[model samples]
Structure formats: structure tokens, C-alpha cells
Target: MAIALNTKLAEGVQKAAAEAGLAVVNGQESAGFNGIPTEKYTLALVSAPEGHTFTLELSAGFDITAANIAPAVRAYLLESAKRLTNPRPDVFVTLGGLPVSFTNWQWPFHLSVSGADTYVVHGGATLEDGKTAADQYLKAKVSASMTVTFAEVVAAPEQPFAEGFIYNAVRKILDQGQMELTKSGGNRQVVPVTTRYYSAKQGKFIFNDTTAQQRADYLLSKIYWLSGVLGGGAPVWIADPRDAQYLNTTVEELKKTAESLAGEGILKLDPKFEYASSTEPLMAHHAEYEHHLQDALDFTRPTFNEEMRAGHTNM
Candidate 1:
């Protein structure tokens, strides 16, 4: 049987993409999404002028027929474009300064088998230590659970609503040393999605409480790893939603911060001022950034009780 395109979703996505300076060059129907058997519509989007391309996987389960969905889709597409302007759109940094890339994430939350009154999504993340060999990198299976209460307020259990917070939650867990990313034989890591992460009054997700200086430091580090090192000095998008959410601020604030950095000659903004690249002065602090990376790696390393390891304790 041939699967028909969801016209509602396609129209919404096309309109949103166009307004975001992107184009839906093509779309295809899939038998499943992230291995779960269900119809999926994956759109291939291209950013004009630069021609950078990325894919967005949308599940058929979204309530696209709803009138309110249009605005949500538009917002998501804009943020999605901003994220792709990153040299490594899939990678995000932890509070510990470690960069992790979450990939192959499943879409549309599934009911919990344990009947815990929650919905769950599954994915995988890898420690992206550019300095380390690929085979030596640490990896983890990620699952995030959203409480039924929290889920009710969500517009949809789609990428837009869940991805940002889920990524932030993973960073929080890694920073707190609650989750382990191992080189081999790792178990699933769960990120609890609770009401604490959302603000009903504000109607948005709140992850971190950061200051201007902290935000500046984060941008600097982001450029260091994502642009200076991995991207070969390519300009990266400054107004990223993921970063804004992680820092607990607005995209406008981040743009203002980027402008400030540009004025100091620490960064060079593109002609459009939408993207930023590291300057000589910024890259000059390579040693400092490297130290921070090493510190983060040390912080996330698993610690064992020496006495227990020596068989000196009984439970």
C-alpha cells in the first residue's frame, strides 16, 4: 500500500520553511520513524545562499489538522534553521564543557510499558571528543520520560517541543554525574521530564539560569569547539534556540551578546551578522579551552569506591 502525504503537515512545513529562509526541496514517506513502525514524513530542507541542507523527520501522529499547530510549526522551523547554521547542528555542549552529539532519536512519544503515567522517546548520544579517535569515543542510549501532567500542556510530542529540553536534560545529567557515557557495554540513561522543566505561566521550557557573562563564555567555548576546531573556522549561527533554551534566555539576548563579542574583535560576524566566526584573539585562548575540556572529561569520568572494588564491603 502506498502512503499518502499529510497535506496539512506538508503545507505547514513549507510555509514555515519559506519564512525561515529555507526550502523544502523534497519529502518522502517512510514505513517507520526511528525504528518504530508508523508512517513518517521526512523533509529535506535547504538553506538558501549557503545551500546547507538538513533533514527533519515528522511523525504522522502530530495533530497537524489543528488550527493552533500552524504557529507551533512556524516557531519550530525558525529555530530548526538557526540550529543548522551551526557547523555541527547535532552536537551540544554539557555544563562540564564536554561536547556530546545526540543522533538517531525516535519521534512521537510512546506510552510507558510500566504504566508510569508518562510518555517516552528513545535516542543515542556519543561523546564528540574531536581530539579522540572515533572508535574510542563514549556512547549512551538515551530515553526521556515526560509526565502525563507535563505532556498535557505540550502542543505535540514532536521534535520542537521535546528536543531542546531533552538535550538540556541530558547535559544536566552529565554535569551532575548522574549519567554515564561509556566506551562499551553501556546501559540506557533516563532523563526525567517533569513539570519543574516547564513554566506554565511563561508557556515555555526553562532549563538553566545563566547571566550575560556566562552566556558570553558559553558562546566563546561553542565557537572554539564547533567552529575553530571542528568547522575549520567556518561561521556558525549565533541565535540558536538550543543554546537559548540551555542558557535560559531569548535569542535576541544571544544575538546582542554576539554583537558585543564582535565589537571586541573576539568574533567576526558574517556580512549578514547572523553567523559568527572565531577571531585570532579568540582562537589564541586554545590552551584555556583545552584545559576546560579536559576538566569536563575528568568530571564525567565514572568513580568507583576503592574499598568496594577491593572486595572490602558487604551489602
Candidate 2:
């Protein structure tokens, strides 16, 4: 039998999800990284587009019954509804201009018992090259310090407060060439999570400083990697908040960029004008996108002088 869910948390989450045009398709008890009990919900958009019925997994291991926690959870669920409309909600783009798919995430944050003042969440991110073996992935441990947890993040180490920056920190690490997605045998890498990725002043997360052209290129590359390559030419949500946060831009700007691409015959917008499918013009740039992906992968790889380390060469 499954464990019982916290009444207040379940009610609030369901209410928030409904208000955001989502429905709780399923709910059940789940376990966390260390076998901690959790409440897991499968959320889906009520009016999801045909050929796309994206489901998002939301798991809570902390006490979310507090009034203060409600607002953050509400905001997260609302944003999640928007994000699920994305062609691939699980995939995130790195500043290296690569798209990586994150999955098998051990949801919610767990407090450290090693006398460390921190909380951590574990997950895996796979490079979506369409050619790499699925078993290869980057094992990531996202951590939050006690100071930032109380100061910027909510008092509780919940999904709503920690998920956004955790995702951004993974992208940041990839951009800085700090971590690499490897085969299954590799050890988990730590992605130090902090509020530096969050802007309390702006009331949002900040990952990269991108220009308009850069953003445009990112959208095009997203379409190429996700839709053209992985999604069977399906449409992708252009106004994704995750992308907005990653690019440090607004959803409206993303819409405008999509419209621009549509105007240029690079994209075909759906009737709603929010989602767009790649056109032949966009697909024709496959070689260019392949080149960009190769460049990004190379840039994210670290270089070391093996010969010098082996005493085969002088410093």
C-alpha cells in the first residue's frame, strides 16, 4: 500500500494545478533518494495540444502545509503548466548551445546529515545528440547552503523554491565546462546551488546574459535539436518560462522571436500562435546546427596535457 499524502499539501497542489489549467491525472506515494516518503502527482494540461500530452512529475518530501509555502508552490505549479506545453519539458539548453534532457530525478531536497549545513537533490542529465547511447548521462547533485536556503529560498527545502535554480546551476556548470555527461559508470558530480542564480531584486532566476541575436539562435537551435531531431517535427512552445529564465528574457520576447521566425519562413506557427513547428527552411540548416552542437560539446570538454603529466614533456 502507498503512504498517505499530507491533506493540506495535496489540496493546495491540486487547487493550484487546476487554477493553472492543469489536472491531477494521478497521485501516489513515492520514495526519495534515501527512501524518504513523498507525495507524487502527475500533472497534465487539460487542453493539451494533439500529439502532445506532456506530463510533469511533482514530488514533495517536505512539509508544505504552511501558509507561506502555498504561494511558492502555487507559482511553481502555474509555471509548470506553461512549461509542460513545451515540446520537451525535460530538456534544457546549455550556454554551450547544447540541449540536454534531464530525467530520473530524485525529487525534493534532502537535508544533509553529514554535519553539513546544506540540502541536496540528485538527478541525471543526458546529452540529446540523437546518436549518443541513452545510458550516458551526467549525474548531478544540486545543493543549497543553509544561509541561502533561509535568506533567498523558502525556509523549507521544497521543489518550488529549489527546482528552478537547480536547473540553472546545472546549465551554468555545463556552460563553464565544469561537468560532463558520461557513461553510467561515472560518479555523481556536485552542482553547488546558490541564490547567485536567483535575483531577489528582479524576482526571478538568472542564468545567462544573452543578446537578442543569441536568443534567436537559441530558439532556432532548440527547434533543431528538439523538434527537428528528437520530436518528429512536432511543434514546440515558444514562450516557455524555463527558456525565458535561461535567456534572461520575457515570454513575450520569445513569442515575438517565434513570430519573426515564422515570418521568415523558418517556422510554422500553430493556430494559437504560441507553439511553432520547424519548416523546411529551418530543417535545411541541419548541417549548421550539427556544427554548432559539435562546437558546444568540444567547448564544454576540459583539456589537459597528458604527456606532460606523464613526464614525457617539459613544462
Best by TM-score: 1
Question: Model 1, range 1-315, lDDT digits (tens) per residue?
Answer: 122555666666666677876776665555333355443433333634345455566675555446777676677777777766677877887756777888877777877778789888888888876787988888888888888878888877877666778888888778777777778828777889787878899987787788889888988888777788877898888777778888889888988898888999999877666788877899899888888877776676666776778789987
Model 2 pairs whose backbones collide: none
Residue range with the least summed lDDT across 10 consecutive positions in model 2: 49-58
User: What is the TM-score of candidate 2?
Assistant: 0.83
lDDT of 2 by residue, 229-268 (tens): 8777887777777778878998889888888878888888
The C-alpha stretches of model 2 lying farther than 4 A from their native spots are: 1-6, 47-67, 135-151, 305-315
**CA lDDT, every model vs. true structure:** 0.75, 0.70
Native-vs-model 1 lDDT? 0.75
Candidate with top lDDT is 1
Error of 2 at 311 (Å): 11
